[model samples]
Target: MKPHRYQGSALLLALCCSAGLFLTSPVVAEESLEQRVTRMEKLLESQGLVDLYLRLEALQQEVQMLRGEVEQHGFDMKGIKQRQRDLYLDIDRRLGQLENGRPAVSPGSPAKLPESTAPTAPREQGNPATANPGTEEKAYREAFDLLKEGRYEPARNRFTDFVVRYPNSGYADNAQYWIGEINYVTRAFEQAIVEFQKVLDNYSSSQKQADALLKIGYCHYELKNFAKAREALQAVITRFPKTTPAGLAEKRLQQLKNQGQ
Candidate 1:
């Protein structure tokens, strides 16, 4: 038998072709799978960026709202502090009037108030014929005692009598002033204005002129006469600059302005 050489060569060629086909098929399938996975990864990255952007926008809006709330609270706190200061000033003024005697003011200058624990009697003043110093002092002390005891009616009567009996006495101006204070304390605003006015009319040399004017302003304020109150308070500040009454009038004026008066 002659060797079948052609048959062997043909069979070898078929085997090589089959092996090449097998190797190429697996490479193509792997490349296709990798392209699909890359596409999916790109899509997921784009979606993640969008979600992050949305979250950032929501956080910014919330911060803006919080900032607005903080500003509103600051404004409210300022108003509350202003109201507290006004209230404190009013309370302090009232307590000073009740707990201490009125300071002795000089005709042309601010005078220092006495620090004496006990209320002292007024010194003698004016001519002997017009004012009996001994009797007038005694009567004034009696009325003042009644006032200190809070016996308002009896003190009013006694002071009324003292003013009549000792018109030119040193204590007469104080008695008149006290009468106004009594009316003011009793809420007789109309009468208080009238009585306080008398201090100006009758006692040109009185040390209580500034205080009287200040009280007149307060009376007008209590009566809701804002214009009149402003006028009287301004008068105190202008006429008695650097005095205690002037300072008090200024505080009251600020309070009125705050109230839109």
Candidate 2:
């Protein structure tokens, strides 16, 4: 009888411990869904999409690891957080694109200019097609030299006329890029972004895209649109990767995040 009584007591103790663990485990695991959602919202609002994506990925890993073991509150909390994260990312991506300025739309084969005929004439506006390709290029080069000399109006016209007349000339890439350069130097950001994008979309192979991307961001910065600026900078990092533009973009991104702007 004594032996039987001892065994029963031991069984009761084990049962109590199991029950205690089952009940308290969930309470410890739970977190309010509202609180988690609020944190995610704040992160999305405060951080750009890149930072947001990084945080969300971290949060998801946490959720996956704890899913089966946590309380109902915890379970629902994870799902809630994940859903909000997805929604936030989607919204951010779309917004980033809108503000991303123009990326290349479709690539076109860059046109090439014919060699110069000793560079005699500047503009034969009436006989554009018959104008010496080489002479036209040399003239454009001279206009660029004028720009470097701080001659904005003439340089601007030189670039404009080049594009207009030699619409199919290989120098078209260079001509378009120079248009952006002139506008950018003049602090005409709104106009400059459009012009730079024309270069990007039309001349994907142009060595100038890196500089163009950087300037696009700079234009946004000058316009006091920090978010858009960050996106443009990030694109420089993405598209150019490990270049001077990419390095500059990374520096600016860090600065923007630190300022919480």
Candidate 3:
């Protein structure tokens, strides 16, 4: 009887110990799972912050690139507008001269001459088909035509030839002026300055004087010689106050001021 009681007590103690282990094991597992989930949440929150910062940096860089493009486009538009204005003014001035029947300036021509005795003889104004093939007028017309057709290289060559061959012709100043125009249109600002300066030096009394001066200013501006540009533009304003070139200079001066240049 004592042996059986001892065996039964041992079995009861084993059952109590197993029941306690089973109940406490579930509580410990639940606590461990909750801690894993909390840690995962913290790691994800940190990763999200890093992603947000990277995205902000990318957006800032994009905004800066867009600003640069906008500024470049604005500058290009200004140049286009300026070119258009120059072309229109030049054409208008030329047409006005033709309509007024004004004689071209020549080295040997008198300051005042009767219209009938003008150097542009009837043959010079004759039909192009029958006109003298080698005449200075014809050469000038050919060069001018090439320029109008946008054949810049050929035009430059022909104009250069005309200037060299007809230095005493009535169209000498005009030829020199057109050479500078070609350089200006081609964006050869430095060379344009030299060519335009020749017009001012060689043809001081030419009607193109103001135009040449204005172009010098434009060349300097394009070359970023701001002080020289300002000086030339100011000279235009002071010397040819009411002329078209002066007006253009004023507009350019205002632009420089607006740009803080």
Candidate 4:
């Protein structure tokens, strides 16, 4: 009886050990599956972050390229405007030479003028009726030749002498206008204004009247006299409508508006 009881106890111990091993195997398998899923999720998140960083770098490079294009376009536009301005000035100069009956000087050639006996002396002031037409024309041409040669001081002096000696000549108004132009070009705005006013007051019937007024407005603008500039520019538009000077005044008015004046 003692041997049989011992055998039953040994059999119950072996059954309990088998059950414990079966349950523990399933729990270990589930833990390993969960760890594999977590590692996959971490790998996908890291890949997504890397892709986003690469895309952001691409966008920054595109923006830099666009900025360079815009700046290049602005420089191109400025160059075009400068060329247009130079062409306009050249055309106007050619037209002036034609109207004055003076031959255009070639770029490299020296301008020729009529011979004068008293080159340094100012001719005596006289009435146009009594003044020799040949002498008047020659004097006017000499002064214009000096201007075309870029001798501004000599041109200014010759124009002044022309005005003083041949005030009644057909070219007297033109001479006065050129004097003002020289002053304006030299940045003597106040003196230019005074000289331009002479053209308006003394030569109201001259073809240069409109241009003189236009230049006066320009001088006033340079002098920072906004009111006078506006007044003179407006007068040109009103009095010389359909003329080149009027067109120039309109352009200047637009510039003043852009400046908030």
Considering every candidate listed, which one attains the maximal TM-score?
3
- lDDT assessment of candidate 2: 0.69
Clashing pairs in 4: none
Tell me the lDDT of candidate 4: 0.77
RMSD of each: 12.0, 24.3, 7.0, 9.6
State the lDDT at 108 in candidate 4. Answer: 47
- Score every model by TM-score: 0.53, 0.49, 0.68, 0.57
Error of 4 at 233 (Å): 0.4
| Candidate 3 lDDT over residue span 1-261, tens digit each | 367987998898788787886556788889899999999999999999999999999999999999999999999999889777876577557646643553444544443323422333232344443233346566877888887787888999999998776665556777788899889888898998999999888876676788889999999988899999999999999998999899989999998999899
Error of model 2, residue 191, in angstroms: 0.7
lDDT of 4 by residue, 180-248 (tens): 888977779999999999988987677778888998998898789999999999999999999878988
Per-residue alpha-carbon lDDT of model 2 for 105-128, expressed as tens digits?
222422243242122234446675
Scored by CA lDDT, what does every candidate get? 0.78, 0.69, 0.78, 0.77
For model 2 the local lDDT of residue 97 reads 37
**Model 2 / residue 12 / CA error / Å:** 99
* Candidate 2: Cα lDDT at 226: 95
Off by over 4 Å in 4: 1-130
Highest-scoring model, lDDT: 3
